[model samples]
Target chain A: MENKLKRKMLWLDAWDIEEQEAWFSHMSLQGWKLIGISKWMAEFEKCEPQKVNYRCDVFKLNDKSENNRIEFYKQSGWEHIATRGFIQVFRDMKGDNSLEIHTDPIEQAATLSILKQDITKRGILTLLLSVITLMLIVGAHQIDPVGNYLNDKFIETIVLIIAYMSISITMVNGMIHMSKLMKRLKSGSLLEHEKSYHRKIKRNKVVGITVIFILSLWVLTVFLNLMNSLQEDRFPAIPKTELPIVQMADFIDDFTYIDEEGLSYFKENSSFLVPRQYQLEQMVEVPGETWEDNSDIYSPSISSFGYEVRSEWLAKKFVQDLKEKHTYYAENYVKVPESKFDELWLSQGNFNAAFIARKHNKVYRVLYYGKGSIDEIIERALAKAER
Target chain B: MANDQRAPMTEAMYYVLLALYNPLHGYAVMDEVKKVSNGRIIMGPGTLYGILKRMQQENFIVLDELDGRRKIYHITENGREALKHEHQRLTCMVDDGKPLLGNGDSNGK
Candidate 1:
């Protein structure tokens, strides 16, 4: 009486093409008629679930004889329901054997050989992609100074990995299952357990929940940011004058921003590229020079310029990463025993100091080298950061 | 796998050739073979198609007729000779087995 849509994880292997047929027939009979099939899920529409017989055959698609085959099946009283690539699904309206698609085990084996070949090709392609994607992730980690990702771009990195690996794993699973099915069929041990399909864990719900969870997290982050920006006293929007606050001129004395064309690429891949101001000759920096940039894309309302909100665990990692890659710096920074704030101040000389303080989960990184006391300079930078 | 020096044909292959002594298409060959072997030799579409193609390639069978989408094949002179040779080999084996099977429980002494 009404139309309804439902998604299901149809878990039938190569050996269970017959089971797939019977399963489809059962589905239609139960009124959950299959309307579409994708790589991951089967789409069904509700109607009057009537008793029917379904059959799936692996026919060579894009051949001249395909029409003849379809005609022959039509004459035999089977209605072609859908064509998924090479898989032809046909329904017997009366739930009777007007004709059989595969009549014998030998014929079934030949039919399965085609599927075996197709999946083998897919498996090889998936293996190549999985390896390449994994290598890229690892390679990205190596170039990244703070570890696997920038302190803020961690979610994006995880998403990239998951998207690639899910496809790879599905391809691999198909290849392996097809291989096992072919081996058993070839050996004449047709282990067709009648109800083995029912025991398979339905993962459609899990996939649905995961997608919802990720979307909700993204939405929550955006919503929180919107709320934060509206707070006048707390996390206010950045003023137009502060748009170019963190310029290359503050970090180095002579470097250009690699031209405007390359600037975007530079910011996106800053972890991999050093786009500092190159010293042409003797260099003089501007007074009150500080590099203040927030990398978090979700929150435009950065509460303070120098302070970065990160997972609490990353505070220790930030300091450790700095020490481990000390060879990249001009001078080694020794840890100060005592400090005015709950901060670890690492100083190269009396004039130069790096103040790292962890407040709750936020980390404040203050870099300075001047004639005035380090504490006073830190205070000045903090005041400007709040402003 | 060798030509001219043919290995003994399989049961399905042998009966298929026998069934195709008269010109017949795929389904007819399947039906005739089953009848001749008294329901023992059952051939499906895929198996018959595979066997017929292999036999045609080996020059053991030739396409006698191309009826619309159906193909009818007939055994060649080479095919008849191969079948006769296999029959003789099978008869010799059966004749050899008659003595051992006839004197039951003799314990080979």
Candidate 2:
């Protein structure tokens, strides 16, 4: 008959040797005998339900005397089952008169020194990684706080911080627990092999499930946002419904919407920080208008971005960022005092004019490359923001 | 400095060195130690392995032969000298204790 096999995730830490031994023995009584072990899992084979004694020992890896050690244990009636890292598992019949792996507590403590050093090294590595992660997070925010918030990268940053913190905390907790176990062993106390592990197992299971759930949710949200962006139609006809943005029709009369390649489109997006955002780019030509009575057409263009932010403070910051960004190329932006909006700035270059305005929790920026007055465009934008 | 490092041998190390005097395999050494200590010192396989490895590193023991997976070991001259020193220290301790304890009789009680 074919052997039936089963696999189980190992939630216990490597230093929890006694708890592991007891758990393995309990599984054996339920007819599952351990056959293989790894860093994350244990594989078992079906067997008759019988009492068995399981033991775990730490041994140095890559030792030339490893085979001799195994042979000696075999001679002592204990069968070696598996090894994960420095920890080895062995078993024997419960009724058999087999000697324990470490009869002297002090000698057992000597064996644990290797594992203790390993944990200390891992703790240091975890700390280093955590510091790097924190620095990256802070640097991202410091570079461009408004851009980071607007692009919805703050969600990814928060998730990464939480994940790193969870892993670092777990590593530190494991290190401390291992140190306590070493101290007990050094004090000449024998490790108890039948201690109950149900409470710890249950608590770890809950925490593990919660972390997995949160990660899955984050992945799903990112995937859905990617799908939405990919499915957006480019250069579609202008909708008849009123939009929360300034359009070319609002400023020009009898202007025809240009439906050619790379000309006109509308995009809508929402994020946790800004619930509603709209972008519009349109190119229009006045009927029967030419630059110099030649084949060349006088096509004027406008690009407008509007955002309904979460709070008035964010709107103020968004408008300030917009003004700062345009000031680099358009020279100094002059504030339009006593405007209809709460705050406004007008920037003009040789051929193009732009304005950024904010009122309450709404902010909008418009760039017009046409033969139109900048004050007129600002009036239309304020009208849209008021609605 | 070397003498200081090798002066105080643990009980497990002393027993293991004594058992290796006859060029015994790993299991045989453990059995010999238990027999010599009269069931008072039960050396676990892990303890014995660690001691053997350390002693070999210190040049206190040498591998005599290899029979498949079984390795036979023998104590070296350095091992003998260290064991003799440890025995003398133990004897001194016992002599000092005997004067006060009265030869392990009911003197303290």
Candidate 3:
């Protein structure tokens, strides 16, 4: 038996945590009996030379009693030992930590190759992120493919909730880890002359990340509010009549005719046509003078009143357009024959569409129709369609 | 460099500090400390690593990571000064305590 005083434990500093664990596991795999870890410096310091007990903060490995033991300190040219036996294999499997900047050409070349490989991997990840960002930006216009309804809104809300929760969890976890690392790096209470440089670095990184997150949140809120307000403001007031000189040629090309029933059904089923208020114009084109009272027809005085009685006219025109146009939303309009049109218009008191209704003592009926920014959507959709 | 009051510290800490005082690697320092102490008060690999790490945080040591697993270390001027003080204090303590304990000295005073 070897003298008890002659045996020693080997201590290792692996390249990184994985290499360290691998080495420990490998030793155990080779039929070495596992020993318990030494939690503190004191336990390790109390180690008796050539003792069977081997200890470390991580896993502890002990060779079989018959195998010769070498004290880590007693071993000659340990750098060579570490570089040769288990350590060499460990470094090969992981990475070499022994290569200095002033290393010989061969080692330096190998290090450069590893660095190049890492850079390539990073480049690929960056490219993937950029492509994902670009796709989101380009696809922002139609972010909602499903019909717009309370359900779609509910789903969107859920998605936002999930995204927010994930981000919060990740940020909190990261912050906790960072704080722990900082604590480990800092020594005891600071002294007057002691500059805790690492603490300062940690604090700066945390503050910077937090500030960026806050700023992004603020910016996103403001941008969404602005878009919402713009949408609200752009829609014209309802019950107006001037028939805003829309080119008949453009309307004919852009729209197909639909029956009133079909229009109402489409509007009811479509998520997009939420019950929104609107402005309208009804043109009163009189047939060539069998009108006995022709003066009111051309009067500049009644121009502002065109919006007053527009609902009845709007209802009439809305139904007429359904018959004449294949547009989807129809329930927004209700048809009234020329007989009840005047009464319907005159009965409503002084509202924009109602005001115009009082003056029309018309002999013939008019049409009611749906309103939209179809012209605007037409321009955008046409470009995409072309592309 | 020789006259700093914070110099002349405990032999063990001083030698430990000095071994790492150069750009010597960590394991190399462990072996050297073993030789310097003649295997008495032998520095364990783990203890040396711990001290080296602690000293780094204290700004007394810096990792010379020009190599990977080898992790060479060097002492800062502050470390040198601290080691000197520790050496002085520990030596004084040992000298003062020996006679008092009636172990190694003739004069109890």
What's the CA error at residue B83 for candidate 1, in Å? 3.7
| TM-score for each predicted model, relative to the true structure | 0.66, 0.88, 0.31
Top candidate on TM-score is 2
Better of 2 and 3 by TM-score: 2
Highest lDDT scorer: 2
Model 1 chain A lDDT-worst window of ten: A274-283
Over A1-387, each residue of candidate 1 has an lDDT whose tens digit, in order, gives 677899987665443465677678778879988777777567789978687777776767576534445644555556677766567777775567534554445545666777778877877887787788878876776566554323334554566566566667666777777777667666765435233344333453454457557767766865775685576343122232422123223333443222222112111112211211111111123334332342221111111123332444654666566455543565455556665334454544654555544443334444444333555544544433344
| Model 3: per-residue Cα lDDT over A225-292, one tens digit each | 56866765342332223232122122223332222222211001111222221122222222232223
What is residue A153's positional error in candidate 1, in angstroms?
Answer: 2.2
Q: Chain A vs. true chain A, TM-score per candidate? A: 0.62, 0.87, 0.22
lDDT of 3 at A101: 14
The Cα RMSD in angstroms, rounded to one decimal, for candidate 2 relative to the true structure is: 3.3
**Number of the predicted model whose DockQ against the real structure is largest:** 2
lDDT of 1 by residue, B38-78 (tens): 98866644456556766877899997547577767889999
- Contacts from the true interface found in each model, as a fraction, amount to 0.16, 0.68, 0.05
By summed lDDT, the worst window of 10 consecutive residues in model 3 chain A runs over A262-271
Off by over 4 Å in 3: A1-154, A178-387, B1-15, B20-27, B37-81, B92-109
Q: Tell me the TM-score of chain B in each candidate.
A: 0.83, 0.84, 0.68
Number of the candidate with higher DockQ, 1 or 3: 1
